[model samples]
Target: MNTAEVLVESLEREGVECVFGIPGEETEALLFALRDSEVTFVPTRHEQGAAFMADVHGRLTGTAGVCLSTLGPGATNLLTGVADANLDKAPLVAITGQGGLERLHKESHQALDVVDMFEPVTKWNAQISDPDIVHESVRKAFKVAEYEKPGATHVELPEDVASEECDVRPLDRRERVRRPDPDEPSIDAVRELLADADRPICIAGNGAVRTDASAALRALASDYDLPVAATYMGKGAVSDADDHSLLTLDSGDHEEASDAIQSADLVVTVGYDIAEHDPADWNPSGETTIVHLDSDPAEVYEHYNPDVEVVADIAAAVRELNACCADLDAEFETDWYDDVRDHIVADVTPEINAGDPFTHRGVVTVLRDAMADDDVLVSDVGTHKMVIAQNFRTFEPNTCIVSNGLASMGISVPGGLAADLAVDSNVVAATGDGGFMMNAAEIETATRLDCGYTILLFRDDEYRLIADEQTDHRGEHFGTEFSNPDFQTFAESFGIEAYRPDGWDELRDDLEAAVESDEMAVVEVVLG
Candidate 1:
């Protein structure tokens, strides 16, 4: 058997169902092998879109999502999405084809140090120099990518190596890695702290969502009558409909949530990552006693000193904490937080008007109403992301997918495709005009695959997020505006249905139609 075949077999053993990428000459051998393998190869218009699809697939599934690319420019194009997966803590495996071994030592067409190029953005990376090492390399890539604090990993297979004949078999699939339980001492310390605190709250982060600890987290908070706030990516860690939900923290913009955090004497951060929200924003003085609960140890920061760290499986840790707290009759003074919850509910409740152009909140409200509670909503990076993070209510974990860590634009479109492939529910991909144009070509890919999802384009014709920031900081906006083609025409050109809502009622009807339809469609909502 050829090395490429062995690699494909290894992936199949790892339970990889589909791979997203654009094939090139260097990847001929691998492509041919995939053709005969059980794994499906989803060809995308661009490598970036393919990587984004892989990223969302990983985010939705605990397994590593795979993306393939050829040498040089193809490899480089996958960098942004791969970096997104790394920072966003999604399990992703990026496979790149390289030039023949002979030419790799010197200058050659489409040849560069791809392994080195991907080093900065991946958890681990290596070049497959020998055919015998193909199975081991592929196994290791998947293993490392799907491990705790999951992120991106890379494997480069040279043309010659892929074509070489090898007598090798994939390694036996090992048992699932078990997470260690939180230490008894650490759990006791946290229980003691929570029992003594006057006002304690829990800040849920991306880690909590990724670990599927939402139910356990909610139980802990509800049991102790504690309020819970989520970060942008951490949205839906607790159902926004919950009485204790403080909605989301968009860099401390929500005054009520910030006040609650400031008033709290002790903070219990569950699966929190500093990258999503800075500690200094809430605990500027570095004086709030923090109980850090996550799979990994806390990252030291001036404002994030943990009084006790339960570094273990987040779900298990939360369950243990709840059990211990229940025994101690732990109850928090949460009457003061009722005002914060009321303010959050009022802030997110949308208002409707029969206006020429719809406001972001109005559109979001209509869209949210149309979608099922379990449906996925992918938010592309822009001003609309901020609006959705603030206004959109998610009832379940991973129902709202926002690229808060990498914060990349143009992810929602391709990410929607992945979301559809990952789950049984419908998907709604929302993006601003500027961000939509970044990966609009993926509409063709979605159509070709018969993937049914709704794309909501917030037509603002500008980089409104940056423009707003410019206006806020300098009192002027520049270099942020641009024009666009008719979105309906653009979408229809790709053989997808399109809609342009004239008013609020029309938008609500269009969204419902799009969701009920079995074909890919785009709804252009003019945002004021």
Candidate 2:
């Protein structure tokens, strides 16, 4: 058997169903091996799109999503999406093909230090120089990528190594590794802290979503009458429909939620990561008593000092907290935050008047209402991202995907494809004009794969997000405006259905039609 075949077998053993990437000369051996394997290699128009697809796939599934790329530019192009997955805590295994070993000592075509290039953005990375070590390297990549605080990992297989014959077999898949339970002392400390506090709130972060601790988190908050606020990446940690749900806290527009967090004497941060939302914004004085509950220890920051920490499986930790708190007879006050929740609800509630031009809030409201409660919504980075983060309400964890950590543009199209592949529900990819153009070519990929999803393009013909920031920080906007092509025509040319909604009434109908169809479609909505 060839080394590439052994690698493919190992990937299959890891339960990888699909690998996304654009094939090139260096990747020829790996692609040929995959042809016979059960794992399907999804060929995308660009390596970046492939990486984005893998990123979303990992975000939706706990397993590591795989993406392949050739040497040099192919490897570099995958960097942004790989970094996004890393910062966003999505499990991803990035495989890159390298030049033959003989040429490593000198300059060669499409050859560079790929392992080193991937080092900054990956949890772990290695070059497979020996055919005998292929299985171990592949296994380790998947293992590290799927471990706690999941992120990106890399494996570079040189052309000669991939073609070399090897008498090796894939290792048996290991049983699930059990996570340690939170210490009884830590649990007791948390219980004591909550019992003495009157106004306590929970700040849910990306870790909560990744660990699938939403139900347990919601239970803890609901049982204790504690209001729950999520970061942008943690949008659906608790159902926004819940009475105690503060929606999201990243936009800084939810004044009531912000106020509640600032006034709270005890802050219970469940699976919270400082990267998703800064503690300085809420606890500037570093005085609020914090109970940090996560799989990993807290990161040191001036404003974030944990009074108590429960380092364990996130779901288990939250459940234990709820169990311990259930025994307490002390009454906790939530009237203050309950009012805050009301204000948040009112703030996001859209006003759609007849014949009015479409507003960001109005479009979001229509889309949210149109999608099933469990359907997925992928928000590309731009002004629309902020609007979606603020207005979109996801009923389930991972139902809403936003690139808040890496905050990369052009992820929505490929991300929606991954989401659709992962789930049976309808998926929506929402992007602003500037962001949509980044991976617009992926429409052809969607058509070829028969992946049905809606691409909602919010056209303002400018980099509105940066323009708005420029306006806010400076006296004027510059280098942020640009012209856009006819998106409807552009999409249709790719053999995908396209729509241009003249008004809200037309938009709702078009969106419904797109969602109900089995073919990929794009809807261009001009923002007011």
Candidate 3:
């Protein structure tokens, strides 16, 4: 069998149904292999969009998402998005084509030091130089990408390796690799810690969400009457509508969350990835007994040194903890109820209504009014994401998607694109002017792909948060302000409808119309 054919078989075995990428000369064999298989390859306009789509696919599905790229610039373009997955701890397999080893030392025309370039970002990076090792490499790459503390993994295929013939036998997928499950002693220790504490808090991270432990997480938290504070990636793992729900802590501004974390005598951190949260110095104070649980053993000591480290599948560990903790009658903290409330009150960064009457709250209110209960809203990183994090409330879990960890700028458009593709529910993206320009190319993609959605651009003519932070720090202006093209005109350039809202009422009307419209629409709110 051909190496490409065996590679495609392994991908299908891993349940990779959708691949987002653009074809190139180097990856032609892999592309042909994918075509021969049951998998559907989604050809995107740009490699960046492909990576973003793959990222969201992995995020929504527990499976590792795959994105393919060609040699040189094609592979290089994926670095930003690959870095996003690595930093954000998203499950992604980024496959790229490479020149053969003989061309490596010659400084070949399209050759670059791809392995070194991706080393800093990917959790594991490898190139398949020998046809004999290609099958095993593909299997290893998938496992690394999907395992605990999941991040991007790369597999570079040399042109010769892709075209080579081999008597390849697919590796035994079941026995490839196994993550360490929490031992009996470790489980009992955590249960004992949770059972003894009067006021306990759980900080769930990307690990919890990736492990699909939400049900177990909810059961355990509710049993103990624990108020849970989700890091950015952990948002909506438990419903915010729950009575014991605590607001998501902005990792960037963790003043009150830190205070809450310090106040607790026992902190049960399930799948808590410090990469998703700063946790200020990456360690908890000595006063608190921390029970650290995750699937990746490598993550246990890098940040917080826990009193007890339980390495296991997050869902299994949480489920086991729930079973053990269920027998104990733990006292719920009456005082801790007020602690989360006070933090929510203090964390507000009030924006003055000195600019446009279309306030941030007004925008959310209009969106809430028009959107269905299950309709999903994806937001990019900016002042808008924070505003939505604090203000825009979701009726259910997984309804709100934000770039909490990486906090990348160009994510909104591509995130919106993925949401549209992943679900039939109405999708919308809230982005700032600076972030909107980053992936503005997707406006045409949205129209071409018929991803009927709404785009709201907060046009303040400057990075509003940077401007605000500069005013706080330097007290004098620097290079924060810049001129921008009219986004409404730009949206029209993509053949998408554009709406210019002069005031709050007009914005409300436009949002309502955009929701019901068959085509993609952009509503630009001009902020003074």
Candidate 4:
């Protein structure tokens, strides 16, 4: 069998059912092999879209989603998406075709240092120069993709290697990857710390969510009357409506949550990577005892110094904490709960009102009002994402999707399209003008894929989120201004229906119609 055949077989075995990419000379062998197999190749208009789709697929499936593209520009286009996957710790595999072996270091046509370019952005990277090592490399890539704090893996295939024959050796399929066990002393130490604390709080991040530790988190929080706070990607890990659960922190109300955290005696951080949290607002210090639980040992001591570092699976660690805290009789603090509730009312309630024309708050309200309870929301990076997290509430988990850890600009459209396929729920993408233009070409992919998702474009004259912050705080607004294209016209060029809402009334009306429309629609709201 050819190396391409073996690679395809291995991919299918690893539960990779779909691949998104465009055709190129280097990928001809793999494409032919994929066609012969059960794996579906979703041809997208651009390599960037392919990478974006792979990201969305990975987020939805909890498996390594694969994207393929050819050499040079194809590889370069996939970088932003792959970097997004890496930052968010999404399980993705980017397979790029490199120029023929004869062209290496010769500056051949369409040739560049593909592996070197992708190295910094990926968890693991390798070029399949030897056909015999392809299986081992594929296995390694998948392993790294699914490992603790998952990220992207890049595998480059040369033209000759794809065409060369290789032994089709079957690899062993393990039920699950073995994670580090929590040292008994560490668990006992944490148990003691929690037992004595009067007011304890748990901070769960995307790492905890990815590790599927929600049930244990809920139990532990409820047992100890602990208030729960999730970072952006960690939203929906605990139900937002739960009495003990607090939604993603509102920057507008940072002082409120900050006050609560400061007063708390015990802080249990589960898979909480401080990288995703805002350093400007959050600080867990002083007399607070931090018991950190993480799947990755490396991430434990980076930000907060933990009194007890439990390097176990997030679920297992939470389960242990629940067991340890189950017997403790904790008194209820109505005053604390009341304070948090008041903060929610003061900080969050006002934004929900039908807001000012062209403001971020207004755009989110229009979307929240338009979507059904079962509908799904995908947000792009920048101010819109933070606003969406703080304002919008989902009925179920995985309903609100965003590249939280990575905070990639061009993620919403592809993620929205993926959400359209993964769930029968109505899909909507909320993106800024700068973010919209980044991967705006994917509007066609949404149309061609027949994804009837709504693209809500916030057409502010510039990158107001950064520019406003810079101007107001730094006395500078350099390189943050942007002139935007008519998103409606751009969407129309893709043969997709487009809507331009010049005012609040038009926005509300057009948004409602777009949601119920038969095809994908980009509702462009011109902001003041």
Candidate 4 — worst ten consecutive residues by lDDT sum?
Answer: 278-287
| Full-model lDDT, candidate 2 | 0.89
Model 4 lDDT per residue over 364-412, tens place: 7667778887677889887787788876754455667788766778788
TM-score of each: 0.98, 0.98, 0.88, 0.92
Q: Which residue pairs collide, candidate 3?
A: none
Q: Where is model 3 more than 4 Å wrong at Cα?
A: 32-37, 169-181, 250-257, 281-286, 297-303, 342-356, 516-518
| lDDT of predicted model 1 | 0.89
Tens-digit lDDT track for model 1 on 278-297?
88888888888999999998
Native-structure RMSD, model 4:
2.6
Winner on TM-score (1 vs 3) = 1
CA lDDT, every model vs. true structure: 0.89, 0.89, 0.76, 0.78
**Tens digit of lDDT per residue, candidate 2, span 1-528?**
999999999999999999999998988999999999999999999999999999999999888889999999999999999999999999999999999999999987878899999999999999999999998999899888988889999999999999999888998778546568899999989888978888888888888898889989988877777788888888889999888898888433655666779989889888888988888889989899999999999999989989998999999998998887788865688677766777778788767898788888889988887888888899999988888987798789888899988899999999989998999988999999888889988888888888999999899988988888899999789998888888878987988899998988899999989987777999999988
* Residue-level error in angstroms, candidate 3, position 139: 2.3
User: How many residue pairs of model 3 clash at the backbone?
Assistant: 0
The runs of at least 3 residues in candidate 1 whose Cα sits more than 4 Å from the true structure, single-residue gaps closed, are 251-253
